[model samples]
Target: MKKIEYGMDFVARNLGIFKCPVCGRSFEKIVHKSVSCDQGHLFDFSKKGTLYFLKHGVKSDYNDETMWQARRNVLQAGLFQPIVDEISSFLSENRSLRIIDAGCGEGSTLKYFENKRESNKDIYVGFDISKRAINLATQGEGSAFFCIADLAQLPFAANSFDAIIDMFSPSAYGEFERILKKGGILFKVIPNENYLIELRHMLYEKNDNHYSYSNAEVLSLFKQHYPQARVKRINYEFTLKETSFEDLLYMTPLHWGAAETKIDDALATGLAKITVDVLLLMVEND
Candidate 1:
C-alpha cells in the first residue's frame, strides 16, 4: 500500500475541489508531491504543506517578507479582535461546512476564527496570490489549509466551498459564484467611509470626498450575484498603542502616497486611537 502524505489525506478526503490552475480542469489524482489533471498540468505541494496555484504574472503589495511579518505582528497585537468578534457572530451554526478565506494575507484572520471555533471540527482554508503570505500562513495548523492562488481565477472546482470569507480583500464574484455550493454564504468586509479619518487628516489634505467610501458599486455587484444580501456597518474606536503606531502606518495602503515628513509628523504628534469602521455584507448563493 502507498503511504499517504501528511496533508494529502485531508485533501483526498474533503477537498476534491483542488483544480488545475493552468487548464481549469479538476485533478484526477495526487502522485509524488504533485496534483495532476488529465493534461499533465502539475500543481506541486511544497514540503512546507502549501500548494502554489498562481503560475504567471503574480504581483502583490503584500508579497514582501517584511510586509507579511509586519501584518502578522499587527494582527498578533489584537488590533482586529473586535472586528473578528463581530464577523464571527454572523457565521452560520453549521459546523461541517468547508470555509475558505479569499486573499487571506498572512492567514491571521482565518487562524483567529479557527481557534475560536476549534471544537467545531470544520475545515478551514486560506488562499492568497502572494506566495510570501501563504508561506508565512503555514505556521499554524488547527484544521487550517493554506494555498497560493488568485481569487479572481481560483484553483478549485465548481460548487466546492460552503462559505467564502472576504475581509478587506478583492472579490471575484464570477469565480465565487462558480465555486460556492448552493445556499453557501459569502461574508464580505469593506472599509467604512470614516475608517481612518484621523490618519488621513494627519498625513494629507482633508477631503471629505476622499474619506467618504461609497459602496454603491460593491452593493450593486452583491445584488447582481445574491439578490437577497444584507449589509451592516460594524464601527468602533480603540486607542492606538504607541508601539503599534508605526506598524499601523506601514501596514496600511492609505499612506502609500504620503510624504515621509508628514508620516513622521503624524507619529510625533502622539495622537491616540482612531475610529474602526467597516461594513459586513452577507450574501448567499441560492
Candidate 2:
C-alpha cells in the first residue's frame, strides 16, 4: 500500500488524539487526503506516509540525512539496548498505552521500545521538528506513526498521552505537563559526564574547560519541574566496530565545533570502547 494510505489508516485509528496547532481545535476526521479541524486548518500526509503538522517551516541542525543514518547505525548496533530494556520492562506493566516520543529523532528508539514489549495495545506516535528526521523515521519497519512538529508547540490535546519519552532532547516541560494524562509518566534521558568521554577527550585534549562536562544544572532543572521524580543512573560501556565508531563520531554533536584536524585524529585513532553513562528521570503527572 502507498504510504499516504497507510498513514491515513493510522490517523483514522488515532484521530481523537490530535488537535490543530493553529486553532487548538480537535480534528474530527480525515477529509480525503488531509485531516481537518473545525477551523478548517488542513494537514496533509506527505507522499512518504508521514504527516506535516508544523504551522511554519523551521530550520534545524539535525536536518541532514547522514547524521540520522549514522544514528540509526549506532542504535541498531545495540549501544542503547540497556536503556531500552529498562523502559520496556517498566512499560510492560500497563495493559495499554498511548505514547508520544517528544523530539523523537529518526524514530529508532521509539521503534525499539515498541518491539521490546509484549503488548500490541500501545499506540506509538513520534514527532520531530526536523522534516528529514521524520522522513527517515517513516521508512523504518514499524506500526508507529511519525510526524513533523515542534516540541514546544505540540500539536495535541490536553491530557492525551499516557507517557512522553524525551531521549537526549530538550525538554518542553510545560507543554509536556499540558498534554500528559493525570498520573502519566514522563521518561527523560540525559547524558552523564562519561557519555562519549573518549570523543570529548580527543576533540578537546588541550582545552581543559571543554574536556570536563557536568549535568548538575540539567538534573537540577528536572528536579525543579518534578520535585518528587525518581532518577536512575545507568553506567556501562559498549565495544564498537571501526565503522560503528565512525558512525558514532558523525552521529553525535560532540565534534560539531571541533577542528577538522582533531576529528581526523580521533577517526584515525579509532574508538573501540565507549561509555554510555546516563540518567533516567521518571516523573508522574499529578
Candidate 3:
C-alpha cells in the first residue's frame, strides 16, 4: 500500500542510522522495503507505518491506550511547552542532528524538537516497548521515526546518534554509551520533589511518605555512569482546567498505586493549577 511504501522510503534513504536489534550489526542492504544485515537478519517496515526491530519480548507496562491518549491531550494543551522550549533551545545550534527519544510514549515530546526546526535537517527516532504507543506515534508526520523496541538493548549501531533524549523515562547508560559518538549528549528529564504536588497532596494525608522525592540516588547513578553529567531543574506551575482533571490523573504515574475511591475524590476536587517540577541531565558521552 502507499502507506507502507512511504515508511519503506524513509528507511531506504537513511539506512546508515539503523542496525539489527537482534545482532547489533549494520544492515548490509535495504531492498524491497526490507533491511538485511550481514548475518542474514532482515526486518521490514510495517504497513502500519512503523519499523520492526524488537527481537525479544515486546511488552510494556505503559501500553494503555487511555493513558497514552490522555498524555497526548495534556501535551497538546501546552502544559509542558516550557520544558520543550528548553530542550529545543539547548539543541538549536545543531542544524542537523541525529536524535532518539527513548521510551517515547505517543511521540509528542520528541516531535516538539522536529516542529521547532526551520528545516527538516534533524533526524528524530523515537521508540517504546509498547506496540500501542508506537502505533499512535507513527500516525503523525514529522522528522520522527517510531518503532516498538526495548531501551536496554538499542537497535542502532555504535556512535550513531548526536544525542539521546529520555524524558520521564528510564535510563540505559550502558546502551547509551555504546550508541553515542564522542561529545554526544544524553538529555534526560526526571521529576523534582514538587512535580505534581497537587495530586500527591490531594491523594495522601498531610506530609505523607509519598510526598517526599529525592534525586540523590538518581544523580548518584548518573554520575556513576558519566562523571561529567550536569543537572538543571526546570520548575514552574501550569494552570489546570477543570476539564483536564481526568486527563491529568491518567497522564501521570502518581495514580498507578492509588485506589479508585481516592482517584474519584481528586477528580471531584481537582486543583486549578499544578507544578511542573523536573530536573534535566546533560551528559556528554566523551
Candidate 4:
C-alpha cells in the first residue's frame, strides 16, 4: 500500500488515542483521507505516512534534512545503543504497550523498539516538530506511526500512552503527565559534562562558557518534579569511524550556531573518539 494509504489505516485503528488539537474532542476514523472530530478539526496524513498537528509551523535548527539524516546514521551506528537498551528493558515489563517518543527526530529510537517487538499488538508513535524528520521516519512504516506535533500541546488524549521517551528533548511535564497512563514510565535523558568534549574544545577554544558544560540546572528541575525519580549515569567513549565522525559533526547541536569556517577548523583538530556522557532519569506515575 502507498504510505499515505497505510498511514490512514493505521490512524483509523488507533483513532481513540487521538484528540482534536483545536477542540479537545476525540478523533474518529479516517474519512476522505483525513481524520476529523465532531467539531470539524480535520488533519490529513502526509504522503510520507505522517500527520502534522501544528496550527503554525515552528522553526528549529534540527529541521534540516541533512541534520536528521546525520542523526539517523549516527544512531544506527550503535553509539546510543546503551541508552536504548536501558529504556527497552523497562518496556519489556508489559506484554503489550503503547509508547510515544516525544520529540522523536527521524524516529531512529522508535525504529529500534519496533524491530524488537515480539507481536504486532505494540503501538509505537513518534512525534517531532520537524516535518522533514517525520517524513524521513516513514521510510518503511513497519509498526510505528509518525507525527509532527508540539510537545506542549500533544494531539494524543489523556492517559493514552504506556510510556513516554524524552531523549535530549525539551520536556513538557504537564502534557506528559496528561497523556501518560497511570503507572506509566517517563524516560528522560540529559547530557552530562564531557559529552562531546573534543568538539566543544575545538569549536570554542577561547570561550570558557562554551567549552564548559553542565547538567546541574536540568538535574535540579527534574528532581523538583519527581523527587523519587531513579537516575543513572551512562558515561562511555565511542570510537568513531571517519564517516561516523563526519555525521557526528552534522548531527550535534554543538555545531548549530558555529560558523562554517569554525566547523572546518574544528574538523582539522582530528578526533578519534567522542565522549557519550548522559544521565537517564526514570520516574513512574503513582
Question: Best lDDT goes to which candidate?
Answer: 2
Segments of candidate 4 deviating more than 4 angstroms: none
Clashing pairs in 1: 240-273
Q: For residues 1-286, write the lDDT of model 4, one tens digit per residue.
A: 8888878888998888899998899996677878999888889877887888998978887778998898889888877888888888877654789999998988889888777665646888999998888888888546788999988789999999989999999999999999999989999999998888888887775565777898999999999999999999989988777346778888888887677887997677667888899999999987
Cα-based TM-score, every candidate: 0.89, 0.96, 0.93, 0.95
Ranked by lDDT from best down, the candidates are: 2, 4, 3, 1
Worst 10 residues of 4 by lDDT: 112-121
Model 2: CA > 4 A from native:
none
Q: Supply the TM-score for candidate 3.
A: 0.93
Q: What local distance difference test score does each model get?
A: 0.77, 0.87, 0.80, 0.86
State the displacement of the C-alpha of residue 176, model 3, in Å, after optimal TM-score superposition.
0.9
- Give the clashing pairs for model 3: none
Cα lDDT tens digits for candidate 1, 199-228: 877777656444445667876777787777
Global fold similarity of model 1 (TM-score): 0.89
Report how far residue 273 has shifted in candidate 4, in Å.
Answer: 1.6
Clashes of each: 1, 0, 0, 0
> Any runs in candidate 3 off by more than 4 Å, and if so which?
92-94, 206-209
